[model samples]
Target chain A: MALLKIRNLTVRFATSTGSFTAVDGIDTEVDRGEVLAIVGESGSGKSVSMLAVMGLLPDTATITADEMSYDGHDLLHMTKAERRQLIGREITMIFQEPIASLNPSFTVGFQIEEVLRLNLGMSRRDAHARALELFRQVGIPLPEEKLTSYPHQMSGGQCQRVMIAMAIASKPRLLIADEPTTALDVTIQKQILDLLMDLQEEYGMALILITHDMGVVAETADRVVVQYQGKKMEEADVLSLFEAPKHPYTRALLSALPENATGDRLPTVSDFFGEAVR
Target chain B: MSVVLEGRNITQDYHIGGGLFGASKTVQALKGVSFSVEKGKTLAIVGESGSGKSTLARIIALIDAPSGGDLLIEGQPVNIALKRPDPVLRSKVQMVFQNPYGSLNPRQKIGSVLMEPLVINRPAIAAEERRALAEAMLVRVGLGPEHFNRFPHMFSGGQRQRIAIARALMLNPSLLVLDEPVSALDLSVQAQVLNLLADLQEEFGLTYVFVSHDLSVVRYIADDVMVISQGLAVEQGKREAVFANPTDAYTRQLFAATPVTDVEAIRARVAKRQAAREAAGAPR
Candidate 1:
């Protein structure tokens, strides 16, 4: 059985003007130890679907699904406490902006230790030791000193490492990384991606990487799901998807890559679907 | 072949942490870098964070004076450290920053935002003329005159970037220093903006000093490339030469680390795997 299964998932947010459908009905499933990549632009609902799965969306958001399950447990039927207990331990997520996601007021060490203690019921000393261990595992230099430093004191890469440490502290069965390397430089992005893949292998965790970067998807993902404006455009194994994209939107996106350009101008998505799509 | 902007051994140093009695520390952000941008050509400065690429951009744009070395704009020596720069000379070079949202004024209308440069630098121009130029600039950048009354908050990120580009062109600058101009945008919008930039450069015969960390974007836009690492230029040559065969170890490492999306290569690998599976008679 798949580790996660969702069918007909939809997410809508209430706004001052009207209701906004962020995620249209989409079905998704992830097997154990598999790497699935969700590729999309900014408003394509890639992040929103995962946020809905983690139950992290605000009250303004209304999420509905026909079937949503994790490890034989029904996610839709679970109570708030039960869902909370399942999410942070079994299924963890890291956001794009690590520095902004972390609490500015608290030390990173305290934050991770609190998660270890509350989620795993670890003793104080044990939580401290585990926090250090997680930090070291995430390749943070001088874990002892970084524990004392606030989020503001560290660089963007270091803050992301801290976020990864916090996410993997409880040894999650599935990890969701949303644009993990987007905020980093190319070299730093390479390092972070390698580290994430390494940790995913070590823990035997299913990884769901959500990014708009085709290069990253090509390099890391086994299977790919392309989203466009709250709709799933296409899905296939990574190589097949890249070699022969079925959807026009997918073809347009692949052509828009600077490396694939044959002329001075890059063909945009609108060029494929027309200006009406925009 | 005329050099529009030339930097000879440009250097920038920042003094840090000596508020009251303790000795200050001098950090060299740019360590004597030299380069030149030809007329109607794009020179890309590629580097990682804290690699001093942005410092070079600022120096080229005349926003900050270098601690040492000469900057010649159209063969005229410019040393802001020695004396004040002429307004005309300053107006010859314009800059477009990375984040369009943060760079634009939320309270100001788009029309006013476009005309602010002219109001400050070319005050002798009439208000009516400034308004005409701003609207025309807007149209040139793919935005319509109907967007004149709207605020920055009313526009999307792509439109906001168009407005930013239009504003930079108002003064008719010969050189534009774009510091990661499209990095904050989405991929599709990034391509659009890059196309717009290419069109505008052709229409105006503008020279560009583009500072970006993304090698792929640089490869697309840059005629000449300068790879900076740790405040030094590791390699500098034509874009094709540098990209095809980089001599510097740091440049090689950067190229190796950057993920390339080559469909043919991936297809070949996939075919090989399938062949292996077939040889083993694996079940489908």
Candidate 2:
């Protein structure tokens, strides 16, 4: 059975200009232990769609859907209190900016412990022990010492590991990582990605990896969803998407990558999709 | 081509956390870095974050001074450590930053932003000529003349970057130090900006010191490549040579980490799948 499902989901924000639909009606699904990547550029509504799934969208945004369910629970009909209980325990999210996501005033250990204590209802002593284990699992060096360091004291990579530790504190069945490695160095990016995959496999968790990087998608994703300007352009297995992209936008995006350049003028999306709209 | 810009033994050190006679730790941002760019050519400096590529760019662009180094522009020695760089050298070198949103003034119109550089660098030029020049630059960067009146916020990230590039070119600098100029844009938009840079370079005979974390972009734009790690230049040579066979361990690691789509392999696989479907008489 699919762990998460959305049908005809649409998101619109109320702006001063008027109501602008950011995400048009789109259907998506995530199966247990699957890695589903949503790839698109900024303003494509890829992030907004995922944010809606996690119930993280702003109050100004109106989300309507024919069906949106997670683990048989109707997300669209779920009350605020019920979602608050489900979010951290069963579903967790990590963001692009590691430092900003973390609390500066609190130690990394306290953050992880709080997640464990609140979500999993663990004892204070057990939570401390579990936090250390989580740090180790996320591949942070000197896990015990790192627990005491504040977010500012650690490097970008280490802080991201701390964020991961917190996210996986409850062993969430569904993990949503939005551009998790975008801010880190390439080497660190590989390490964090490897760690995420390892944890996902070990815990049998479904991962929704959101990013604009095709290279990253090729490396980590099992299935891919390509979004363009709030609409689903294509969806396929990772290999199939790369090998035979049906959508002109997806093909153009792949061709535009500098890595694919052959000492000639690059082919932009405008070449395939016509004049720029936005 | 002649050597347009050169740096020798560049090093930058920052003093951290010293108060009231407390011993402050000195962190070296750039350590004995050296490279030279040829006239009308692009020299790419590739590195991960905290690798001092940006520091090297700053020194080359005369934005910041290195603690110890000698900088030469067209074989003329310029002491960048001075509070203000020599006007002639400053005018000869310009920089474009990574963040288009922050680099451009939100309140200023695109026309004024483009004209500001011209007015400051060439005060004797007539106001009418400056306006014409700005409009021409806007059109040159792929934006229409109608966009001249728009504010920075009105333009998209890619368009704003074009304006930034246009502004940088107003002085007709011989060298442009672009520090991750297209890193903030979307992939397709990145290609557009990169193509614009190449076109501009050919048209204006401009040299470029391209600093980027992306090796693929470096391969596309750079004639020569330098790899920096922990404030040190690990490797430097022709772009093809460095990319084909990196001598430094760090450079090799960076290559291994960078992701590249195997287009040919994917194409072949796609063809094979198509053939199988054809043989099976699969419906579309």
Best-matching candidate per DockQ = 1
Candidate 1 stretches with Cα past 4 Å from truth are A274-278, B264-284
Q: Which one is best on TM-score?
A: 1
- i-RMSD of model 2 (Å, 1 decimal): 3.1
lDDT for each residue of candidate 2 in A1-278, tens digit (9 for 90 to 100): 78999999999999999999999998999988778999999999999999998999999999999999999999999999999888988999999999999999999889889988888999999999999888888889999998899999999999999989888888899999999999998999989988998788678788999999998888777789999889888999888888888888999999998888866799888788865334
DockQ each candidate and list the results: 0.67, 0.44
Write down the lDDT of every candidate, Cα atoms only.
0.91, 0.89
- Off by more than 4 A, model 2: A274-278, B263-284
Report the C-alpha lDDT of model 1 over B74-97, residue by residue, as the tens digit: 988899878877779878999999
What tens digits encode model 2's per-residue C-alpha lDDT throughout B209-238?
A: 999998888989999999999999999999
